[model samples]
Target: MLPPSVFESAFNSSPIGKYLLSPTPEALILAVNDAFLKACSRRREDLLGKSLFVAFPADPDDPASSTNEAELRASFARVLETGTPDLLPVQRYPIPLEGPDGTIAFEERFWSAYSAPVFGPDGAVTCISHTTKDVTEQIRSERALRESENRFRALTTAGQVVYRMNADWTELRELDGRGFLRDTDSPRSFWLQDYIPDDEQARVHAAVGEAIRTGRVFELEHRVRRIDGSDGWALSRAVPICDAHGRVVEWIGAASDITERKAAEEKLRESDRRKDEFLAMLAHELRNPIAPISAAAALLQRMQLDEALVRRTSQIIARQVGHMTALIDDLLDVSRVTRGLVELERVPLDLRDVLQDAVEQVAPLVQARRHTLALELPSQATIVVGDKKRLVQVVANLLNNAAKYTPEGGCLAVRAGAQDGGACVEVSDNGIGMAPELTGRVFDLFAQAERSADRSLGGLGLGLALVKSLVELHGGTVGCESAGLGQGSRFLACLPCLSGDTAPQGEQDDEPMAQAPAALRVLVVDDNVDAAVMLAMLLEASGHEVLVEHGARAALARAHEARPQVFLLDIGLPEMDGKELARRLRAEPATRDALLVAVTGYGQDSDREQIMAAGFDHHLVKPVDMERLEAILAGAA
Candidate 1:
């Protein structure tokens, strides 16, 4: 053994932290090496001769320090009693330091310690030697690594595949060893060949090549094949890992499933295409009726005709005008239904009465087609809560559809009964039945079956759609069934039944004639000269004083001169619109009290409300019915 002075010098200079505690109940610190003094951030003079626990007490502010102090004291007591070394687990033992402000502060630390007994010549424990190693940085690094692994596991569980690849795009491997790709053995050059669909291979390859060449982020959406041999959509993104010299060394990437999102995008595109087709069809249908009306007007003006020819030509004009009006009305009805603006007038009524009216309305078409018609009504009346007019229209549309599609002598049947706690009406026809696929979508707006070049079975494909909307608004449902093309077709409408008293009897009246009222002053104002002239002629022929004006200024001048009792104005005027003209006229005493009627093609509910708000008493849409006009005249008189 070396001399005491030499041993003390060697102990103080040792690199490993060492401290000696006197073999006493208090475990007083006798001496400490320079390494131990540095480890605790203290001077030897401050620690020597003080109790070990008292000199470095457990930090009351740190909960972990108490556990560490207890474990350390147990190891020291065991070493002193048995004269053997006792090792302790790594522990968080914070040391106290005097700050520049003279306040005691704790320096957080983790330590690996071993306590050994130093025996004296008498074979008794004289002192306890404790050795320590500071391992704070190592412990912190291990904790961070554990957290990273947990995050990686979570991402894998969420269906995200993490991949690593060479910077040159020549090799690839899934980081988690989960075979997300179908062909795990394939190289980078052929990686997408087996996974991605053939149609998307070129685009995805190009994107990958560009990203590698420019060291930019790679992003692509492509189709992938699953283990079950099914196809799905995936979105892949990757970033380049570069070396210190800014040279690409590796790439990390992830891919997520996006099949549902892609499907939604495709559906939206299909809807847009269908909307475009419907708009084109609408334009074509409108032109068909306008062409004949234009030619008839030109013929009447250019030629002298016999009375029979004149009457025939007039009838043609009337029929075409009616057709145009029906088309416009259907368009408006669809707009109203789609906007949730259609309000139904619900009333308790007999389903049989509605069926009777609908059958009568379509009798002309049924007779023209020469179809054999059969009617089946229940033994008892079926009562339902519904809108009477709308229910009638729904059944009438179904009957008309049957007549239009059936051959010259096909069979048609309409049945009304009670079923499933509801009143049901069904119309079936042995005509050009629809295909199985079309049965499901026949009631879709603008959905039409195959038609001939002449479009002889003319329609805007809005009838069934309107029926469906109206029926649903009445708290009912409509459905169609077909056996296949040319076999037959059937439509059924069901409305919730109501148990109540009998429906009120409807009034029966003879058709009223368009009789002239006692003569009264009338003014017709329209932007179209022909419309103004035609209206004026009709009013004059009815024995009323009539004047025509083609513009707002002209109509204002005419009203001032004539002081007309009735002022008919178009809503779309040149400099000032009809609403403005009506406003100006209402401000004037001469026309304020006159019966103001707005005549225009704009007939939406909002348009009518606007015109009425502008001081008009009535609003009549274009191609106004003669009977309605006659009634208005009589009412005014």
Candidate 2:
């Protein structure tokens, strides 16, 4: 055992604060060492004979001080009653200090305390020994760490793809993708290869190198491999995290899924490109017919020629005009069909008869090409419910394509029969076939194979598109197959077959209507001077008194004066259009009963509706069908 003097020396020189208090309920302070006096900022004489509570009074303003005081007193009481040591918890215990101005202020502090009972000779507790150590700096450091961890959690929980990378970006330390990407929890050296697509990895590598060299933020819109192994897009950004010496330690990054937005942008770009191509093609097509027509007209006006030569020149003009008109008609037809404006006239009919009509329409083209045509039809009648005219049109278009694309002396076959519970019409040709890429989208609008500079195989690429649309409108399907270029191609159309009923008998052809022989007064109005005069001349050739007017106002005045029985008015006129003229003519007593007809270039359904609503009795698209117009005039006569 140590001597009494040595034990007292150790207690007084100890770094921890130590004190002794009487073991009574009053708990009066009996002694204090040098460390205790220094810690409390008090002298030994000031505390010795005073109660422990009086020496360390609780601060009313500091709530933690009150708690610390209660805990210390409880610990001391327990040591006295149990005659054992009691370890106190770490707590905030504020101390009062005198400032330079003699004002007392409380300094915030944290401490860990302990108390033990001291036994006397009689084996009874004489006093309690207390020790305290300051722990303020450690407590404050722990609190700051907790707050940092909470902020990190909040960021990861949001819909952001947070990631951490090594200083040079050569390694991926961690990643929380939040479902937008694949998560990485461990360091990876092959992270770039695993996350980025093969074609896009080089670009990512270049970006990473630049960001590392410059110590700048990295930003890129790039492709990524999704969790399901599908291709996706992301807008990624990473900023350099620096150390105290201004050296980059790592990268903190986030990414957003931009897959849907990128797809929409690509679609818009493709649409714009296609529209520009279509406009250029339209200009080329229009100029082709215009060149020949202009040349023919100049030859007729500038030269003296024989009757035969003059007739030949006129035929050239008429043929080129017909070709131009056909091109316009195809454009309008496709537009109407795609917009769901065409209505089918569905009727039960024999498929054989429909095929026969289609064959007749394409017979001229086939003979000119010197192609051998073969027809394979079923023995019995194949009945189907469809529009006979549209069905004929569909077959004719397919057969025409075969004739146009096949070389001279090629063979073409049209086969029709009942197959797969439906009526199938197959058109096959031993001709130049399509490439693999072209076959897939051949039915799309304006999609076509490569054509020569002269465009010898003349077409606007609307035939197959129209065939597909019309077949689908009849609740059927159409498909094409080819064995590469120069082999062969086949087109198949399938339509639902009519069952459990006999085919309806074909309707008899209508007799030709009788012509009106008596001369009738007629008025023709048009914005073009040539169109008005030519129409007037045609009327006079039929023994009718004809008046020509160049505008709507002139036509209305002429009709009122002539009291004409027939009126052919153009829809597009200067200052006043044909529909308004028709309405104004209908209001006048002199021309109210006239057979009003519309002659215009506009032929859409909406245009037709407007014409009819303006009181016109007949609507005709230009160049007017002379036979139909004659019929209308004959009915009026």
Q: What lDDT tens digits, residue by residue, belong to model 1 across residues 55-101? A: 98989898888988888878887887677899988888898886533
lDDT score for residue 337 of model 1? 71
Each prediction's whole-model lDDT (CA): 0.81, 0.81
**What does each candidate score in C-alpha RMSD?**
30.7, 34.9
Model 2, runs deviating above 4 Å:
1-161, 178-185, 197-199, 225-233, 241-248, 255-272, 449-454, 500-502, 508-518
In model 1, pairs of residues that clash are: none
Kindly provide the TM-score of model 2 when superposed on the true structure, using C-alpha atoms. 0.70
lDDT of 2 by residue, 1-637 (tens): 8799998898899988888888876789887888778777677756889988776677878777777888887888789778899998887888777653346788877889889889999999988988888787678656643443333322223344677888988777556655433446567674677778999999999998999999999999898776567777777889999999999999998766666556867977966775666566667777888998999888888756889989898889888888889889999999877756677878888888889999999999999999999999889889889889889999999999888888999999999999999999999999988888777777887664243235567667788889999999899999889998887789999999997376655765543365764788888889899999988887798888998889777777777677989889998899788888888988998888888999989898767877899999888898877777777777887
